[model samples]
Target: MPFSARLFCRPPRAARSRRSLSTRISAGVTALGLAAVTAPALVLLAPAPQAAALPNGLAATPPMGWNDWNSFGCNVTEQKVKSVADFMVTSGLAAAGYSYVDIDDCWMSGSRDSGGHLVPDPAKFPDGISGTAAYVHSKGLKLGIYESAGTKTCAGYPGSLGHEQADANSFASWGVDLLKYDNCNGDGTSPQQRDTTMRDALARTGRSILYSLCEWGQDNVWTWGAGVGNMWRTTGDINDSFGSMLSIFHANVQLAAYAGPGGWNDPDMLEVGNGGMSFTEDRSEFSLWAEMAAPLIAGNDLPGSSAATLSLLGNRDVIAVDQDSLGKQGTQISSAGGLDVLTKPLANGDRAVVLFNENAGAATISTTAAAVGLPASSGYTLNNLWSHVKTTSSGAISATVPGHGSVMYRVSTGSSTTTGTTHPLVGASSNRCLDAFNNQTAPGTKIEIWDCNGGANQQVTSTASGELRLYGGTQCLDATGGGTSTGTAVELWTCNGGANQQWRLNADGSVTGVQSGLCLDVTGGDQASGNVNGTALELWTCNGGANQQWRLG
Candidate 1:
């Protein structure tokens, strides 16, 4: 339920296999691809190769922004780009985390300069890319430029194949923050080598640039992209059509395990505001992209976009899940007869569930909290992200999703872990209890220190499942992002029974995260500084300090 060639279009298919041997081979490849397409919920490819994450700290979450390819193609201009950047801020897109304004292709001159330096087309970009980038930066945004790995780009502009370092230098000098290195006009070399070459070249520039590989999923980019680029295209270009969007989703959804903090599996830029899809289909595209943790790069005419388009692009609550610090991409949990369910685990232990109906008519899709991996609870809170509607469910999560539409919810478990028995988790040095920010039961709410007032939000229950439940057992003290590193923020999230939510109450008055083995400490509060109310909690090295100690009674 879950869901090139030329213009990067392949040559017309050779005449269908005429010989028996050729027919068999053709059928075999078709069957393999069909399995991946139709059985998206369970199809698993052979394990991808293990690779280190790119050292670049950019894209700790999937990148959110806009690209010019899907809408403008080669008609991009500096004035159009500047206007979109202006709209990005004025329409609240930048505030909602859409930062990069990308120029897809054709921004370069038809030929390189006599000095061997790449040049922006003076006619298209009168002030040069550096000046345009300065203007974009002035508005608190970043600029992305596109190039190709081969001798020429998809549009036949000079590529970076033999000029990697020089082009990287030119880009860095122009203040480019992101590079969409495409797979057009390449030599016979492997994709990995070409992409990695650019990766190293970008590093040599000494600027933190996010590298995006547009290899069209050839060479199984996901297997090695983490070490080379921030995000790699897992499919061919996307068109402004429902059929095209659905096919891309099917191809990209099954590769979820390969995406994370430093690298993401890109399904290609979004076509949300394009005229081809209906409003419902557009919303479905946006929801599915966020659900899959794909980059939210808008590929529409932003300056001329309708109000509906702006609202869909600027939904912060939906964006939060895609940009969640956990960096886990959602996967299809169930798919049958065109009804699909996808679940993504958030940093605060909440699960984002999307019920999508791919059929021609609306249908009711159902799945339970337990099925989606939430801990058992007396009730579950379902916050409809698109509709902003709230509902309670004992366990089963169901909704009537419209045809070619999706209904997304931020689901949190509300069942008490224990039967009316709870105790306070008090800071050993501060003598203040752990409290949910503002007593809010929402996922991702900050966990802080507060006076021990016997409030339900401070009542903790050490459950058999290894979770320290609070908020009358609805919330858990979670290590943000499941991070095993020191200084990771601690928060109150819906109890999902994840390792990050598991804590050990040691005899030394310390509460240490089971995943990180780091003691919970009052942020910036030591014996000399004294812990105070509302101080945030974080995981720190276990140094036997009083600030790192806790008493659970």
Candidate 2:
């Protein structure tokens, strides 16, 4: 999250009249403060409530749909938006529950009308804002608009920096129901000033517009974003590829505590419809986002979506995870090389577990019921979201996850016997070398094996998979596969499930390939504490030395 610049100012006051107005204002403020203090401490102390009512007390989840900026950019037009809207209704997207039709950037002309108001580009939106909004509404969808906090938008168009009121009124008059407010050019001197400006503007609109603050996690927006807007983007702009998506998603795990209720921590829009990534990555992206409680705004040409895209987007069980009434965002409970276990509390008193393989090769991620914070001896009724299959278990749930894929299961208390065998070194362990591995690996690079000492470099975890992850739905790690020869580089690659991803820790503290049987040996047999890049590796004798021993905790 970015920090806002601070602004210092004194309150304006007139000598005599100022004294009277100041006293009244101070009293009102004091009274308000006292009222807040007098309220039940739970109401005040509890993290912000997630269940604030929306307009009309609507009980349904927010409608899902597509936006155009990501793929088409400044090329968005009325015909294009209308076609997408029509497609939403005709392609079964509307019936499947997506309802918002949004226009991103560069749709506006460089000037306002005679009324000193902003105007859409004549060629792009010939019928004007209201006309386009009506056309979208006619398609049984809501209309969404975009603006920047600075003087100019991403495309250098007019922004809402000093004209929040004007823009808010304009949006409301145009029948706009959603606003994607970007942080392009704002004098965000402080958190209070930046948030207050946007909040006050949205409140002034009178009409209940869903304010989406695109501030990219600045100022811990998730903690207080509900007071400012309906949702806030927690990361920078997202790309259409899986690596970018995973990178963004894994980076925001700590921010999960800030998301709930009417406010959410956005990981940016969906990249499902974009064709730059593999099909498995698309599925992983969808699954991870839903698991994280992210807004499901599609960013693609909806009119020409394929069946696979539709199937992925229209998965009801996955969508339910995203729209869980409990509004809790899932967090990373454990991770190891290119694999992760994420858990979220569901509305029905069950828990959703997503076992993700973030490496280039297939990998196994296992966890006992106790390790997942569940009762040791209790059975769990497991329902697979993707396959819609049911299974019963009492001890641990373990599965081999495909590279860049996930296994999503809804687990509830049940009566069943535990029947799974536990890996000798896998129950619960931690590794310090994992940190060294993450800090040293780069994209398209080789995973270098080195001598492990009891120092931070040698400790390994069997509890968590070793996959490095990004917050939200972004991907960042790349495991090219175990090398054919010793000293081959182990580097990070965009997540594509492949054999190169599998890593295992033997009981004697050695890390080996799950597929190749090659051990991860320290380069040059160097037991030196501060090993740097360009370190070479060769097959060496395993002596169960501290340098060779690793523990996963």
Candidate 3:
């Protein structure tokens, strides 16, 4: 079995939560949170209201690059930022998609100008933000600035509190492409109000700058972050320590459903290459971020970073998963003895799994394909992400993970489907999800695959009872009255939790009825796409046919 926040930022006392995650979870994840923490509710509310989708399409994936916070902090200056920008380009981080060179708190003047607009501290930046932005752009990297939603930034710089529009206009005039808005000194402001104000102001500037909400998840920002910014910090500031990184990962992993194309749940900046962690721990940090589909913004001094750190930041395969078009976050499937299995479904029928050993010494971890949401009948092509080694395996995958280290694998099921935690179940061979037969709800309707869309007919779910439940209640994929023979019709029927309704996801990528001992297969073994998309599905022999391979991402 495998499965897996304390905020330490300096701030007003009330902004801190006494909660230290004292509960030691004995088992695995249940629902959206750990079993023990569910009663009090870890996340306070539902996602931001539907109307709050903001920032248009920028920061669609986790923003990747380097920020000055973890390394230089308030010591960041014009030369320092420019040097990092140069390193990003020279070290191939920019070419590898790490574009934003951001300056965190303390980059601004202590007070706004007499005109009530933000002004960069000339002593530090030398060139104003506009000129700095131009230099960054000339190097093919984006420029990011920091400010607070409150009256003052954490480092005592003038915040954007009362000058939202004016400051927004100034940033746009300076060609800023990213904004990391913090929440310190926000006297009477709700995270929502302040973030929303800036969001509106950014839009007014007519520049598509990526808005980052740094509220530290105090106000249930995910419930409304989409309405405010492209990515929102889901945790407090991260220290360059394994414990700190682990706490943040736990707090944000289960919030996957709240993340998608336009908005993301940020776990804060990367601490890799920083001196606080061993290289093994650093790899674990990078692996976890990629697993969460979180931003890969490196926080180390790029110039001083070792070659190993650069390689970790530039691993195109791990980056691919973080930047996958599907934009789904990975969830922990199991946890025990400090070993965790987290799975992220990819754009194709591929799955990325990380076996993280959090113990003080090395540990052996194993996870069955089904546990990672892979069908039992299908074989997977696996690539050890860190080693760049590829292999194939069926049944289950296992590894001896180093202490405080991780092994990540990108697995492709050969076929693809959209049936995911909230999306429809797609038949790998059919390129569609299992839908209600003829779009019917009554019992005994033929279940088939159709082009996935808003129609509830295509939606499916995997339940604890092992039923392929249709979106609507009362109906599920049934075995046509306990039939076990090949070619038995699989139809929609009242969900009675009967053996005929019980299905086991197999290694062969087929759903087998526990009672019938047969696999779910497309009629006539159709691997053909297009017009025959809505082909009927039935119970058939598990002969490892392409039509029997089903995947849910």
> lDDT for every model?
0.79, 0.61, 0.74
User: Who wins the lDDT comparison?
Assistant: 1
Error (Å) of candidate 1 at residue 445 is: 41
lDDT of 3: 0.74
Of models 1 and 2, which has the larger lDDT?
1
Q: Rank by TM-score, highest first.
A: 1, 3, 2
Best TM-score among the predictions, by candidate number: 1
RMSD of 3: 18.3
Q: Is candidate 1 or candidate 2 better by TM-score?
A: 1
Model 2 Cα shift for residue 297 (angstroms): 0.8
| True-structure RMSD, every candidate | 17.1, 15.9, 18.3
Q: How many clashing residue pairs, candidate 2?
A: 66
Q: Report the lDDT tens digits of candidate 3 across residue range 1-553.
A: 1122233222222222122111111110121132234313655544333334564678777789888877876778999889989988887888888999988877877777788988788999889888889999999989999887766665666778888899889989999999988776665547788888988999988888999888766666777888788888776657778887887787788688788878888888888878788666787898899999998889888888654466578778889989988888898888787699999988886789999988888678898777787766666766666644445677567877767878888876643222223446555444556778666788888887677775777766666667777765457889987798998988888888799998876432456789878888888744234226668888987654446655553
| Predicted candidate 2 versus true structure: per-residue lDDT over 1-553, tens digit per residue | 1111111000111122333334323323322232233223213333444434333222244336677776677788888888888888887778777777888877788766777678889899998878989999998898889887766665567877677788889899999878888655445354336556866776777777777777655555566676667777665556667766776776555467767666777777888858877656777888888888888889877766654466568777788888888878897888777678988888787778888888877677887666655655557876666644355787577776666777777777885311121111111011113323433433554434333334332233222343333221123232334454554544545544455555553422355554455555545433334243434333334432223333332
Ranked by lDDT, top first: 1, 3, 2
| Model 1 TM-score on a 0 to 1 scale | 0.70
